[model samples]
Target: MSTETSVTPSLDRAMCAELDAADPLASFRDRFALPEGVIYLDGNSLGALPKDTAAHVQRVITEEWGDGLIRSWNDAGWFAKPVALGDRLAPLIGAAPGEVVLGDSTSASLFQTAVAAVRLRPGRRVVVSERGNFPTDLYMLEAVQELLGGGEPLERRLIHDDGPTLDDVLDDDVAVVVLTHVDYRTGRMRDLAEVTRQVQAVGALMLWDLCHSVGAVPVDLNAAGADFAIGCTYKYLNGGPGAPSFIWVAERHHAAARPALTGWHGHARPFDFELGYAPAEGITRFRVGTPQLLSVAALEASLDIWSEVDLDAIREKSLRLTELFISLVDARLAPWGIGVASPRQSARRGSQVALRVDDGFAVMQALIERGVIGDFRAPDLMRFGFAPLYVSHTDVWDAVANLEDILSTEVWREARFARRGAVT
Candidate 1:
């Protein structure tokens, strides 16, 4: 038997077609409900809807909710949906069953896990996180600091590319370190196992925010020996808007882990009508309250598709797509001062690439108008996410081609594009 190897193909549209024809996951593209003529490059922000999502939600509404009503909590297994879905999601991130459970939003999950992680290490008063982390994570951490702090908030230390490296900030006083596995804006990935080792060596717990890495890149939380993790289902997971987040606690941590929220769902004997709260065993202790069942239904449908996916294959295709897009941008768009903002090395990059360009907000607006949809970050970064399940080599070529045409024509300077939306 021979091992197949990947080779870089020349820059050509016909070559892209050849690559697509040979793609093992090409058939999976039809499973998504993308609009006609729209090359979606924003799966990192919000995933395209799965074709089965609507029917699945509809069945849950008409049969489970409408017909079954209250009986559905048990008969339809609605009560167990969060833990059950977490078990299904475990494999994608190298987690074990009973070690992961769904939570509210990513912010809420971070607060839940961060508080518990801090409590695990008493006497340590400092929390470490990246300056580049998603704003919500930092925001939630602020609340954690105040709530846990005795009159004074816990000191927060930020590590950045420019100064005060992780080594500089690590000390005996650090309680927990929360960092995103893959940076949300620049698409840079961290060495999970290595960072875990570094944090643990200094007597600090490492909690990962895997929002961008879970479905797009290869992650092995247990293998990395991480203490805690939380990620959302709405992005590459394609669970639809406002889907729930999930939290993973190492089996070893369950015995001593104390979640901040003591909602009835986490109570060991909820139906007993006890006045006091006693958390349930294992991952169930992290649950705050009743889950959004309809949203969980949508996630359930998406997980069905994920059950058959190969993470290694997804990683391979992701690198291919990102590499292709970067190459095209460098070759064609560099004349307009557009440069790749993400790491050039595939090992250090995730499934998305960020491009640095002038007037990026307007340029992204123009790109969206032309149907090559990506997104813009605050100062000057245009992010393009390549979901291997749907985005193809041809899509990469077309996106760059569209971007080039927009830059050359100066259409991005138009008044309509300059108008900013509340979300962006």
Candidate 2:
């Protein structure tokens, strides 16, 4: 509970073994395809591959596509994957059946839902958000506003004070309040329940960008009274890169809420070729296009593994791993000018911890060279993500040891490491 800085002993293999023995999800680590001699701490960016994804994708490609051809869409159950996968993912995020649907990128889903929210609240012009939200969320909102420009152009109210409270901005004129449940840079979390209540107090809709918080933190969207939500599959879900994203609309919105992107797939009678667009009942109306079978299959494979594990357990282990990393790094690396940028309070933090150092990029490059794989953000933040399913406690200890060695020897000063890479 102490926010006051203090140091703990360096992480050791013995401590790791004890933690691993106590971990309920320890056996689940074998389900991933982690590289040998490397400690992966970038699950917040792209998750490590699930072992089943290869075979699942192969079956979809060879049998479903090669054999079944266009007929596979119906025979192989490809048409239902979006809603089916949503049902599978519902329990992890505390959403009920028929409330969530999968499709499109996170940005596209946000645009669709934001437009729907505006339509639901007539005559509202303002959309509340925070400045530090992920760039795509902000950009998508701007694009939507531009596309629908009348006197009702969407306006953004960015929060930018020390621990700024959003209560004041929840006015009657605000149509939607879009926010990232967990901050991408600082790993800070917002109280979803309280924020939803505040936004609804003035008859405004709450749209949560759950890209960072979905699998890493415990979220009860239904319990929190969340109106709409969207998130990607790649991060803590262990789905592969560029995986399709999901959108959830409360059941209350199903009958009345109108989808902005009214594609043929979402029409109630697609085969009838109706001239008018009558939206499909329930969450199926959120589907904007044909499902990506390969990506959805990969997500299914990963979610299969997740289905056997408890989300609450994942959250607990995530906190333990992050806390251990912070304690160890602060004790050993603080003398070299590393400052923890993430919130010290566990409740306010996500699965990742951000550390600030003068040469963060080069330091990360050195760590990568030494078999530890964390990422470097802009300016000076070194981001380390702890994936509870695949990352072991021993990996955390090894990563810290490599960091300590790099800082002690100043190996990051090498000219080769100082040069920026394409991906970083």
Candidate 3:
């Protein structure tokens, strides 16, 4: 934010330009509607707006909904979009066809999958999860435990993160284990297959909350033998705000796990108007209510962008971006009392990086004022995301360059910066 100051900078813009030129994913930056002179490094929290998404939603609004009216559900293929979009997104996470579907938010999907997972193992009374997991997950598990066991409650075992793996936590008493693949605060990643194996060894079902890992990193749900997973669309997926979330269940679990929300759409014969409710065949049974057409249209358009993208290229660029950011921070801001909170090793980290600093909320505010947008968490942590599709090497360089001046001049500690807002 204080880049145009008295201090002479060392990190040159020319070197950053050269790096962007050679980057294979450089051309894809034009796909998003990025503003002039802004470096959007917060894509891991909320993704940049896709260029094509607006037009796609408009077509659905004017032609499909406005013109077709009630018939659009069948005629315009609106009802089938959730499944189609799920099938399209399945390959991105290494999931097979007919195993994934779209609807609701990540919180609701977590509740749905978790409820069914616990029910499948009827005899087991313990539900295991981490205290450091996303807050909604822990809350949902608590609710699921109460609802499932009726008057007799199931125990929700919360394992604190003293070390990596839950050696003593995974036992025969556990019925379901919920975990977030990539941690939100530190960006620490867990080994999916190894954890899955441990959960299964004790005959417990594994449910992964992929909120931070889905599109920004590699997640092979099927290859790793994942039982269930749920993730959001507004972040790395580049869907618009409040985009519908996705749910994936292994083909084997469809018959055994029941849908928690028994709405009309999930009924086998909705039009038949039967007196009793019947679950739809296969994955369709997970569909709870009428499909969210507008949000689905925006997400479907975003998925179209993914069809041309190679995840390998995206991942490679992502690592480079994060590496560059971390190196720059260590070189320039280390002496200023800033500390890296994220995993140092490339293989063990997510697409985002976090830094520990005093007055982190104000520092982020100062950075945002300069158009280098990032986010801040509670206590003292500043987070920056590197979404490969749009962010370039030069953008990363410019962000650090601005940060260097901000820290050196103590610009972040200004009285105006102390002001807080609702969202931050």
Candidate 4:
């Protein structure tokens, strides 16, 4: 499949419609249950609902839960849903069947994997990560540091765009390096294989937080020789809100790796009710407790949609969509000082792009009001995600046209748009 379609960067809606018509993945858009009169570009934050999700959940509830009841754990395959779903999700990230398993949340999974990674190299005292990583990873690491630290907490070394690069901080003392595969705010992607080699060369394990990269980009944990990885399903995966996160441990680490959460579900003989904790063999060791089954059912439904699509095709459409958006923004919105915050290079970026503007929050609110739903990060970046399965080229054109009008009219300066929400 060609990642690039020959489309001219013209300020014409008809051209975009042509691109949409030619898009091989265009039919997949109908699989989603999107709202009418809404252009959803927020898949980086939360994915749009799959059309099959509600019916699938209803079936599970009525047939499995309502009818089967407790027997559903055995007959309905509830006990193995995490591992089963993990196997289904493996191909998207280039992982094997037994290497991935679902966990509670991205934060909990990070803490679980990070602790195991730190334990792997006992004497090493430092953990390296980016300063701009999603706050939850850093917050979870703080807890990991305190718990593992005998007298004093482990030293946390953070790399930044300004100074103290990864090469500067990496050394023999570093036990593990935890980094996001794609930056959430800026959408800057890292070379997974090269970074893994660099971290391992210093005798440190690489634990990738794939929260932004998993469904948005192609990831190969084994191919990169990465030690651990964790990601959420609600984003590009289109799982419902609060869906379970997943953890991937390299096959090499399965035997010796010891996660911090030693729930009975992860016990070697979970049904035996063993007094002492014994971690289950393989990825099952990562399971903490009884999973939120309804959420898992929702995720399982989403996975059906994923099973049909091709990752390379998704990547191709993703690049095209982002490229179009960037080109349009540069050509039309430049006079208003709107800047692309993400990497201009397609290879160095994920599926999303960030636009830098002074009044990003208010502008995003205005855009949301106009039915162009993207999101804002902190002080200035307006983040837009392009899920190739649903987001069309014409949608990109309409988004930019709407944005151009908003900036030109100064509608973003209204008092109502300025009223901040607790979530944003």
Candidate 5:
């Protein structure tokens, strides 16, 4: 039997083959070590391993940790990885050399940025954010506010729509407007440039959560006049799980913003052991604790791959992959109540598509058993992420074919597929 189906003309196997042939990023698939029989479509949540990562990790463990020991901080350049990696990543996100710093988790970075932003705009206690933002961003702000005080004493405003206007909430009383550049659930992208301008008009600082935007989208933090931003490397950047996250403070704010969680490493002169709390110059001041060596090593290995490719090319191929997934899935699964929840327009969507289906969890389980790995969110949303670096147009076609087979044969309707797990 042929792996062919009659659907939208653009979604056919022939069209996918043509797209694969024309793809500039086609060769990049070999750079990753994906399983032989699996079509991995969850790169938005956790990226697949790069082929070079294992060897790099082994060298770090054997040479740096075993042989160099404490001296590795100087000889192997271990102490400077945060700043050095930040410099390497700056170009990918359109930032300057001293603007970005790598450390901690996305939650920690958000808290640091939020605290600095509120402090910068003293007497203005309000933090404006969207209701649909990632839960961690909202929770972190709430925790920060509670630690400072109680009740509505520290105002927290939540926006509810995707419209162009935010001027209503961007008032003088608002100290910071914390926003995620790309909506995590719906995959809807916001206008970063316009939003930055609006927030600045009210004399309020903007702290962007680039967790979904950073490697997948073209972000010009400096050009957009953005004040602060934070993101994780495990997603589109392909850093391994639990890898350290990154934060960016514009060159102007580097000297002004003060980090709350100051540590010995962030001291101006660590060996001097000064009693007073003097911060290091520029972005170095934001480094609050000792860096995670193993995780940082993994992230550096991933960054090596990122340095070779152009982000614009990555964005182009990402859009093509998502478009193909949507076009194919809609034709095959719409009859079963699977509706597209992500933005249809390429410009307004990120690198993923969320399909709304009544039995999303079961459908996803069935697909997983068939070697097509995607994930499901709450309240009927099947999320598929297309990482252009390792995912190909042919992989998209195979994933959709597996979905069609599962739905047509009633394989997903089995009661055994409904068991809930700790993590999705």
Candidate 6:
């Protein structure tokens, strides 16, 4: 495929209709419960809700919890949901069943895996990561360092490499290399296989934060030889907000890897109620605490819809949608000082396309008011995500049309739109 296969889009709705008609995934749009008149481009931030989620949550509350109470943990199979959900999600990222499990928040998962990686290589005293990584990652790493880094002189070296490759950073001193698979702000992608190989070659383990790469992009965790990985389900997975994050540890590290946050649930035999903690065999050990039952139930409902869907189709549609948005923005919005901050090449980018624009927060707020719901990142980036399962080509075309109208009329300059919200 061309680096950026551009689509002029004819500046017309008919073209979008034609594209939609040809889309194999078109019928899936009705499966979501998006608000009327809204073109949701924020799935990269929070996914659109699946139609079955509410009913499932109701059942969990009314039947499982209300009636069965504590017995529901066994009867309703609540205890096994994390592993089951992880199995369902495995193929999406090309991971095997026993390698992944869901629990805890993304930050917590990152902390566990990083600590374990450091412990595995006691002599190594440095953890190398990108300076541009999401703040939570750097914060979590710093937290890990303070707890573990003592007289031995440990360092959390944040590299500012302009390129994705860590040619200058990976070394024997580095116990583990932490990097996000896709950049959160700019939507740029890293070569996972290449990076993993390089890290391992230097005797350092590789841990990837797959938050932005899991659903929209295809990741072969085992194929890339990635030692460890962690990701959230709430984005393109369509899992509800605060849905548990998942962690994947290579089978080789299962016996050696010991997470710091050892809870009763992660214990090998919780029923035994032993005095000391013995981690459960396999991925079950990654369980942090009692599962967030209702949220996981909601996620199960979402995953049920995802069970039959092919990820290749999702990746294919994502590129098409983003390519359309980029082309439209380049052709129409450059004069407004709105330029693509993300990679122009589809292969080099994730599912979201970020635009560097003046007053990005205000512009995104304006777009939201106009019913185009993308989001703003700090320091001038407006990100729009394309989730193929529900978002149609017509939605993309209409969103672009709305943006063009708003830019041309200077609707973004309104004082109400300029006023910032706490969340943005």
Q: Rate the local accuracy (lDDT) of all candidates.
A: 0.93, 0.87, 0.86, 0.92, 0.86, 0.87
- The global Cα lDDT (0 to 1) of model 3 is 0.86
Which regions of candidate 4 are displaced past 4 Å?
1-8
Output the better candidate (4/6) by lDDT. Answer: 4
Q: Write the per-residue lDDT of candidate 2 for residues 1-424, one digit (tens) a residue.
A: 3333232575468978888999999988888888888889999989999988999999999999999999988998888889989999998788998888897999999998988888888788888888788999989889767765574557778775464558666688888899999888889888899989988999999999898887898899999998999999899898898899999999998888887899988889878988999899998888887877788989999999878888888888888888888888877787887899998888888889999989899999999988888898899999999989988888888888889898889889999888986888
lDDT of 3 by residue, 5-32 (tens): 1222365678778879999888888999
Q: Pick the candidate with the highest lDDT.
A: 1
The C-alpha TM-scores of every prediction are: 0.98, 0.96, 0.96, 0.98, 0.95, 0.97
**How well is each residue in 110-167 modelled by candidate 4, as lDDT tens digits?**
9999999999999999998889989999999999889998889999999999979999
For residue 19, model 3's alpha carbon misses the true position, in angstroms, by 1.8
Model 4 lDDT-worst window of ten? 1-10
> Which scores greater on lDDT, model 1 or model 2?
1
lDDT of 1 at 139: 98
Clash count for each candidate, listed in order shown: 0, 0, 0, 0, 0, 0
Model 4 residue 174 CA deviation (Å) reads 0.6
- What local lDDT does model 1 show for residue 14? 91
Q: How many backbone clashes does candidate 1 have?
A: 0
Q: For model 1, how does the per-residue alpha-carbon lDDT over 331-423 read when each residue is reduced to its tens digit?
A: 888789887889888888888999988799999999999898999998999999999999989999999999999999999999999898788
Residue 96, candidate 5: alpha-carbon lDDT: 96
> TM-score for model 1?
0.98
Clashing residue pairs in candidate 5 (N, C-alpha, C atoms within 3 angstroms) = none
lDDT of 6 by residue, 1-424 (tens): 3567578735567888888999988888888999999999999889999998999899999999999999999999988888988898888887898888997899999998988888888878888899899999999998778777875447877777565347777778989999999999889999999989988999999999999998889899999988999999999998999998989998888987888789888899998999999998888887888989888998899889888788888888889888888888877777787889889888889999888887878778888987889999888998998888888888888887788788788878888887776887
- Ten consecutive residues with minimal summed lDDT in candidate 3? 1-10
